[model samples]
Target: MSWPRKPLFGSIRARLLLLLLGGLGTLMLALFLLLDFSIDRQIFGRLDATLLGRARGVVVLLESHPRDDAWQELHELVPEYATGGHTDFVQIWDAAGSTLLSSASNAGNNLQRPPAPVPANAPLFYDLRLPDGHRGRAVGLRFAMPGRADEAVLVVAEEREQVDQLERRVHVALVMGVVGMGLLAALLSVLAVRGGLRPLLAFAAGTGPDGAPRVEPLPVARMPSELRPFADALNAAFARLQAALGRERRFARDVAHELRTPLAETRMAVELATRGAPSAQVLAGALASIDRMQRCIDGLLALSRYEAGIEQAQVEPLELVDLLRRSLALAATPAGKREVTLAASLPDECWVMSDPALLERIVDNLLLNAAEYAPADSTVQLALITSDEGCTLRLGNAAPQLAPDDVERLGERFWRKSAAREASQHGGLGLALAGTLAGLLGLRLHFALEHGVLWAELGPLRPIALPESPAS
Candidate 1:
């Protein structure tokens, strides 16, 4: 059976807080455990030492006096062992396992014996239940008596209730301290996380009413070092978005401006037909205006399709020379009307890989644009230049009116040299569409005006070798 997945924390701030608090809590718990263990060890160590010292004192007394006077001296030297209220106890046993002396605190009961084979010089410390029924710690020692060859075992024990109580108090204090530090750490973590994310929050606040990003750039300098790269990326994205929005606005304005004249012309022509003007003339005007509008709309749609990746190029090997001739043939009528000559420099078969339809549109637009703009009786030159790398199609014409700087604006939509719109039937979208289609075909269109001639160069289009015939 599959188990349901747990939902993760959504907010970065919450995640960071949880991580910091969890790590700090674990560290504090470990520190508390370490300190508690060390403190407990130290407390018991001192208790064991005290018991050993008392046991050693009893042994010293036994060694100093003769057998007859040893017990009396031990009673005098260590009076606590004789008192009923005392917690300290001592027991001595002979080599033959006979008890010689015990503390009065034992109430005739003996302390538990140490394990067998106790060390001779070093004391052995252990824990046991005392005769008085209290938890206690003890030390065992073996020593030789004065004027005697036999060794005796001496055990010293004390009730550890007070030490355990102190340890409990220390444990409580440590718990309280750790809890306080954990709370403080959680607070600091929250503050640190919030402070670190302040820049991102500020960026969110800068968004527009429609939830679009504002034009103002994000403040990268004030952000943390780790977030600076993120901030820079966001800034760059916002800059591009702003540029795109600006372009869209300009495109809308230009489209409206371009269509307004034709629309007015169409409306006027319709009015004249209603008022009984010549039917042929009125219908001709209306049809011409409609045609211009259709062309503009079609160009806009084609450009939009290519830009949006809705139209993909289907590349194949095609003859560039034949394509150029077809484009020139199509532009012949317009060029002749403009009194411009169409000239071509061609090779027999220049094969290049490109989408045939898109390449045809590019050539047609370039030829039409040149024919419309070239001065009367000027020659529009179309050449196919081939090299080891690939082929470049160069189209040039006399552009005495166009300045060097004007070359860059040639591909912009609806851009024209003259302010008078009545002079030209073309909407100036031809070059823009051509450039866009060339890019979609993975071809580069470069414009350069040198010595009063405007040149539009397309390629280095990758050439494809001819397919061999069946006989070959």
Candidate 2:
């Protein structure tokens, strides 16, 4: 699928920063919420304990004697007992359920008793609404005075909206802190992410000017652990690119060298034909030069396409023996000129599935290469080995010039024999292209000298599918 060449607001750097900071913001907000709840619970617990203590103090004061002046000291000591401007409010009821005593702080409000009979000395804490339209907490108890058997119910209550409001303010501040931190973290994260990717940016500069090697490679030593693999891969690719550039320049130079003679001859002939001096011969020479150039160009293109694709477009089952015979026939006149004889052993027919043009090219290159480099008056052998598994085409040529070490470089592009023993017009793309063709055709191409005879073999060919049996 194709995407827009450039999309707005869709960048890896921006997306990464967003994801990183968003996750952190969510985590921070959750922690802050938990913290708010924890703090609120702690504050409310402490406040409830304080209110309960004040309620107990009031209970203690009400049980004491008033004539001993202790009540005055009690009023001085206890906040709820003193009553004015205090948050704590108290109410007491006699045995008949009459409102007996109430704190000035109550403002005529009281905690209601439970409808059932009260349990003695038991205290219950509950939430209630105050007369002033605020929420309150109340502690109620049913108890008798120090000497009386009849029951009295006492209550202490306080407005809680203020503490609740304060807690809300704290929660708001915490939430604001989360928001502020989120923004700060996002900004910092963008900067940090950019800084973290700096080395990668430096590692990835534009490719050097076309058809040239890079001046320098990326610094692998300084790359962080996270990006080391990426750096290594880029370096590897750069190395391959550099090698390809070198090979391309060499190939071009070889092509120019091969074409110079033909192109010069063609130019001279065209000039002669223009002068009307035996135009037909000059024209024929020019046509031959053009055909030579066309062949070289075609070979280069075929090699390139083969390297770039695993399979050629038009593939079919090729008859290996017939292709081999045709290639040998084409090589015979050249071999006869060199006084080199051709020998062959093959089946009546051998079949392998491959692109026929590519197959023909490989066979043609192999036979011609053998004929070109083989010793004059020597015999070049051709043979094909076949089985139910696969087929291998072999070409054996007499190559007295090739050493053990020289054999290894035979298929390298633009490579030639160390000393030019004969005048041959061809560039050294034949064997290299043969190798590429073998790869594209799913065959093996290699050379070895057994008793000073160079062998160029291509196969085992692509596997032929076996026929399926009918259902039993």
Candidate 3:
């Protein structure tokens, strides 16, 4: 079944980073707001204290002088005394509650400071609404004159509208800063992710990442240190791949070269046999040659497919005894002409996993090679034994002793023990093809020379349960 494909960024990186940044920005903005509020509170607190102190001092001066010029000078001093970003206005009142003096902004404005029961020494700041209907922080202080029966209170206040406006400006600036930084961070993250993926691109560009001989190695030093280990691993993998491909390439070339001589000779012999007045003996010989070429062509095609990784396809269970019985049946005809007896040693119900066609081909090649090389009237035996690991299939023939090197090189294409034997049909590529197919199917194929007998086996059997008949 096919799955839906998504866009690269939307499916992978962009969404991940956006979610990450969104979380980070939210946390950062919360902290920024908290800190901004704390600082604003401290700053405004200090401004309130300074304005209250100046009001207290004004009340003492107004009670001592009770004059217009002196009160006006006291208000002028406030503008100079107040801290940066703070403004002040003052209004002086007589004992009879008349406004004696006031600043320009407070002209004809009377602020009613509601009476509270507190200590005479306690001068407090409170929120008061003036006659103009505006809010301000008002500090009121009452003092008694030395020679008068009445008491005068000097009140001073500053408009608090600017504090609220400052808060709004701060909030806007903070939002803009967070948005700007988030954009910059996301851009850098994209660049960083791309830079890290560059080495993977280089590794993918090679001809084959697995075992192919033609694969080239990349320069490891040019890559980042974080990616160096992966590059080195790929280089090692390519080395193994190159070796395997080299073997396969050589096998193909050698098979073609070996088959060409017999094919060309067969064609020539047929041409001569078909000409006028040819003997029956010559015709029979030509027919044999043609048969040999046909067998070689068919074997080579099967071997090529096996070598090219076609064995990865699923194979059904093949009864081991049935497979061997069929192979011996076919090989018996050829063996009898050469005075060789064929035999099979196997259980009645042994089963295995394999492509029956290819398994049959493997068995035919092994038996044909053994029959040709075995002594006359000798038994060319094919044995199948059940074991703990799997089934063991062995084919043995009476032959001369094989050297250790010959056993090691037995399945190499075009390799033979003797020069004269190399020219024979049984020598060059048959065993190599059998071995190749066995390997592709994950089976072990090998040769051993035991006491002047050469043996080829295609197992350790993979066991399976046989199906039961529906009725006896």
Whose lDDT is greatest here? 1
- Per-candidate local distance difference test: 0.85, 0.75, 0.70
Off by over 4 Å in 3: 1-41, 52-87, 92-155, 158-248, 270-275, 311-314, 465-472
- lDDT tens digits by residue: candidate 3, 1-472: 2343344344435565656677767877787778787867875687678777877677666656756655566646655322322345666566677775666655555666536532357666677765456666777766664445766666777776676577667767776776777777667767765665556655566535464433456677777787678778877776766655665786578667776776676677678867867877767666666666666666666666666565553577877788778878888887898899987777767778877877777787898888777888999888887778888888898877467567888777667667777446553567888887777667899888888888887787588877788996
- lDDT comparing candidate 3 with the true structure: 0.70
Model 1's lDDT to the true fold?
0.85
Pitting candidate 2 against candidate 3, the one with the higher TM-score is 2
Per-residue lDDT of candidate 1, residues 16-45 (tens digit): 888899899999999999999999999998
Clashes of each: 0, 1, 6
What digit string (tens of lDDT, one per residue) describes model 2 on residues 179-272?
Answer: 8988888888989889987876765553344545565776778778877787677677788777667657766776777677668878988889
Model 2: lDDT of residue 368: 88
Candidate 2's TM-score reads 0.69
